[model samples]
Target: MAKPARIRLAGTIAATALCAAAATEAAAQTPPDDSIVLNQQLQLGDVFSHQTLNVVDAQEQVTVSTSAQGNSASGAVENGSITVQSDQDMRGDAVAGTDMTFGGDTWGVVNATTQAQGNYLAVSAYDSDLTVDATQSNTGSLVSATSQLGDDDARLLGGAYINASAISNTVAMYGEGSFVGGTIDQSSSATVRAYNRIETQYIPAEAVIDSQAIVNAVQVTSGQTSGQNLAIVQTSTGAFVEAESSANSGNAWDLAGRARATANQAVLYNEGGSVVADSRQDNTAFVRAAATTTAFDFGRAEAHARGAANELSIGNNDIYVEIDNSQFNSGGVDVTATFSGANGYDVYVGADAVGNSVIGYSCSDCGGYLEARNSQTNDGDVSARADTTVAGSTRAVITGANSVGNSATFHVSRPSH
Candidate 1:
């Protein structure tokens, strides 16, 4: 009986110990939903003196990771200041389904990452006498960041950085001092808008920059613009344009290898400049005077129109050209420059028709007019009363098949009653 009692007691003690261990494990496995919420708003008042931590929080649907592994740091967020001496590195990442918002500021070193769909991110950083960096990569998304620096000096770099294939993204930078040394690179097919209004700087090769407006001193670039529109470049003191093109075709404003503009009349100037408009189709070039006191001044304006069966036409304006050289083909109407200001002028020299076809027109006034099928090249007669002297002759040249060409050519001829 004594032996049995001892054995029973031993069994009872072993069972109690097993039950205690199981209870301990059950308590430890409780969900950490509340702890995660508290850490989200955690702040440090000051010096984190020699505190080592490797924390990992992984939940079923979401996760928050915080790590610090290196030296000396001092900074503040919402009146909370933290200073760390001797090696410190921090990394925090969050992932979810709907959206994610992230923020950080480090005097030591920091790295952050996030992944989600249909999200927005706004991050900022300030560093003193230290190096700061940020990187991001995403698709079908949008991101924006703004950073500032103090006198101590800070550097920021970004990579592949922002990708939003089917969305729009904006990145802006503002600085009080200067870019002592830093770089920002952003690339995407989707539209990107960057505003850098620094005093003056240099932008070298394949650097794409777009802003609604820019005020700068010097710029060097090789660029191209298409689509029928207007390109306005404004400078307070002076403006310059040096350009060259291969071809321009189709429409009322097809400025192929040309430079033109409209401006105030009082102080109009075009020094050491050239404007060339080549019209290779029917009624291809026309200039309209937007102002009444039209002061036209062109330095070295040479307009050329050449090719089989092409025509160049000009309209109402005051034009003063230092050197004007116009070229045309046998089946092409070389020059047709005309103005109708009670005092308009005409300066042109070339064929009267294109291959057996004659171009003619009859006009009672500017408002009432009727043109012939072949009159596209016909320079019939010009009648005008103006204060300025006008000198030019209208003639017909038989470059088309002489056997098939017709001509009742007349210059300044009014039919007699």
Candidate 2:
């Protein structure tokens, strides 16, 4: 086998600069808006027989807006509107390495607004490391829109109004190395008034690995209107080791809103022992309304893991609605785990809604209107142990409706030993 490339951080910088330059040239040939906002691509062949270091640091901020108006002959404006928008796209790749250390950090932010019957919006997308093959260690942090919004409108409008997304991390790592530590964070917010609407949507986070990996932490937050979060991890021949995730959503006053977190893990191993410990936490709060209208606040958490000759443990927690509301709503939590490997054990735990909701409403028509529907569904705990040659066990625990409308669910499956 050929020796791996011993590239230092300086060499990595030089290589990245060259790649950026090439990308810039390619971008220049295309229409201004028809190109990717940011892109990073790394390619390496062969393992690093010697110790090496590779580092990448990047940061960016963007804002975009547009407005229009029409005035009548009498100097009165018939219609006036404004629109704000922002978007980001990123890509990266790395192939080849052993006994090497890699570090990277990328951060981005966006602010958008529209006034006078206008709308405000913000969006972000990340697609990093299409393919990666490193046999040693990897450490990095990728974050977007973490700070609180300064504007008054943004603060009042809440978390659902801002939209942020991470499409996926298409990476593949092999050999006996460990992922070590890494974090992926994304957040955004938007505010609007006067017959306006705000919406935020996020796709699931995805990753694939073939070696021992440890995810130190992962966090996501959404304010105001609506928020959604998801994560998926797959390992073909190694153990996940340890992982943790947290998701939160702020107040939502009108219409339908939700906050959710989900994780999926799959491991395939024929021999040897494997172990996984993954935990997830979710929170949704301050869903209230003064008018006699309908409102929905939902918080959910889910996880699934599968492997052979291994031990798996998972936890899911949710906090749904902490303030009183005149409108009807529902909130809950869901957890699931699956292990296909023989001679292994699985454990799962879940909790939902552990807080207070003070009531204060002064609307004359509230009594006349029918009370809003309120419901919380807790699936309870479930576990199954299937065929196994040696020894195996499955356990599940759940806590639901500590205060208000909160539900928790859990499920586990394993082969008998």
Query: Which candidate leads in lDDT?
Result: 2
RMSD versus native structure for model 1: 30.9
Cα error of candidate 1 at position 14, Å: 2.3
* Candidate 1 per-residue C-alpha lDDT over 140-258 given as tens digits, one digit per residue, 9 for 90 to 100: 11211111111111111110011101111111221111110121111111111111110001111111111111111111111111000011111111121111111111110111111
* Per-model TM values vs. the true structure: 0.15, 0.19
TM-score of 2: 0.19
- Highest TM-score: give the candidate number: 2
Q: Rate the local accuracy (lDDT) of all candidates.
A: 0.18, 0.20
Local error of candidate 2 at residue 383 (angstroms):
17
